[model samples]
Target: MGFFQRFFKKVEEVNNQEAAASELESELYVESPEEEAMNLWVEIAQNILVNSVRATGNSVDRAFVLVEMREQPSFDIFYQKDGDLVMWYELEDPAIKERIENELLPQAPSVASAVNGNFAEIGQPEITFAQLQFEWATKAWFSHIIREDDAHAKLAKDEVLHNWFNNLSTEIKTQQLDSDTKLSWYP
Candidate 1:
C-alpha cells in the first residue's frame, strides 16, 4: 500500500477500536466520585481546545504534554495551508514554551518520515490524567503520545490550567454530556 493508503488505514483502525470500546463502556458505566472528577477535567480540556479554535479559527493538529513540568501543555494547531512554518503555536507564556521544548518534544530521528504533509514521528505522550486526557483527545480526534512517567498523577489537578480554561459550569456540563454521548456507544 502507498503511504497515504496506510495512513488512512491506521486512522480507520483507531476509529473502529474506539467505537468498540465506547460500546463496552456504555454497557458497564457506573457513576462515582472518581468518574465525576474525571469528567470535569475532560470538560476543561475540551473547552481549552474549543475556545482556542473559536478564538483563532484554526484546527489543532496535535497536542503535546510536558512530562517533566506540571505547567500548561502545548498544542500545535494548523495556521496556513501552505507555509514554511505551519505547525508551531506561539504561546504567550514563555515558561510553557521552555517546558515543551525541554520536556515534551521528541528528539527527531535523523530521517523523519513525512506523513499527511507533516512529520508524524514523535514519542509517546505523557499523561497527567489518563481518562480525561485520553477522552479529550479521542473526542477531538487529535492524535496524542504518552511517554512513560512515574510521577504524574492519575487525574491532573493543575489549578493554573484549570483557571485558564475558565469555561462556565453550564457550558462544561453541556459539553460533558455531548462528549459522553459521542464517545459512548449504546445498544
Candidate 2:
C-alpha cells in the first residue's frame, strides 16, 4: 500500500479499536481510573492544539517533550500540536532534559507502540495519573510521527486533527493539566 493509504488504514484501525473498546466498556460497565487518566491527557493535548490552530493557520505537524535548564531542580514536559510556525518548550530543568534524552526518548517509541496496540495495557489498576498522562503524551507524540506522511490524506484528516486538538483541550482542563503550555519556545 502507498504511504498515505497505509496511514489512513492505520488511523481507521485505531478508530475501530477505540470504538470496540468503548463498546466493551459499555457492556462491562467498567470505568478504570487509568483509562480516565489517559482520556484526561488526550483531552488536554487536544485543547492545546485547537487553540494553536485557531491562532495560526497551520496544522500540527509535530508533538514532543522537551527539557530545559535555567531553573534549579525544575523540569517540564509538554505536547506540541498544530499551529503556524511556533516552537514551544516546557520542563525547565536541565537534569530533567538530560534524563529524558538519555532515558525517556529511547523508551518512548516502544511504550507508545504498546499503548497504541493495546490501550488496556496502560489501564492497569496500579497505574498512577501522572504515569498515565506521560504515556498518553508519549503515544500522541509518536502518533504524530507515524501519521506525519498522511496529514494530507483527506480533508477528514484535517477534521480529525481538529477533533484531536479539541479533545486534548478537554483533557487538560478536566485534569487541571500543566506543563508550561507555552506558545513559543527557544532551545
Candidate 3:
C-alpha cells in the first residue's frame, strides 16, 4: 500500500473514533423524558410506602403490608394474613395520604364498634392497617353469607387472599424487578 492510502485510512479511523466518543458523551449527559418520569415516580412511591410504614409505628402486624410501585404510577399493597401473603388492594390515586385517609380512616370506627360489641361510634378513632384488615375480612365473610355465595362460602378468607394474590402475582411478575425473589420471599 502507498503512504497516502495508509495516511488517509488512519485519518478516517481517528475521525470515526472522535465522533463516536462525542456521541457517547452527549448520551451520558442527556436523559430521555421517560427515564426522568420513571425516576420521579419511583422516588415518590418509595417515600409514600416508607412513610406509611413509619407512621404505623410498632403496631400488631405492622410490617404486614408491602408496597410495590408499577409502571402506571400505582401502588400495590401486600397484606400478610396468617402467614399467607396477598395483595389487598391497589392505590392508584396520585394523592397518597388523602386516599389513605378517606378510604382507610372511615373503616376504623365501624370496625372498632363491631369488635367492641357495641357497633356504635366511640368518638373519633384512629384506625391502623390491622384494623382495616379486620374490617375487610369480616365484611367479605358476611357478604358471602348474605349473598349465599357458595363459591367462597367455606374458605372466604383463603379465597379472598389467594384470588387477589394470584391476580396481582400474574400482573406483577411480568413487570416487577426481582419478581422471582419477591414470589419466593413473600410466599
Candidate 1 clash pair list = 124-145, 124-146, 124-147, 125-145, 125-146, 125-147, 126-146, 126-147
- Tell me the deviation in Å of residue 145 in model 2: 15
Residue-wise C-alpha lDDT for candidate 3, range 1-187, written one tens digit per residue? 2334445555666587844433433333334444443333333334444444433331212122222111111223454333344433332333644644555434434433332222113332211111011112222110111111223223333344455456544544343332222222222
lDDT of 1 by residue, 1-187 (tens): 3334445555666587844433433333345544443344344445444443334333332222212222333332322222121223464446544544453343212101111012112232233322112222344432222222533343344442343233221233344422533221100
lDDT of 2 at 186: 18
Give residue 95's lDDT in candidate 2 (0 to 100). 56
Candidate 1: misplaced stretches above 4 Å? 1-30, 58-85, 88-140, 143-187
TM-score of each: 0.29, 0.25, 0.29
Model 2 TM-score, 2 decimals: 0.25
Which ranges in model 2 have alpha carbons more than 4 Å from their true place? 1-28, 59-187
Q: Which stretches of candidate 3 lie over 4 Å from their true place?
A: 1-28, 58-78, 81-162, 166-180, 184-187
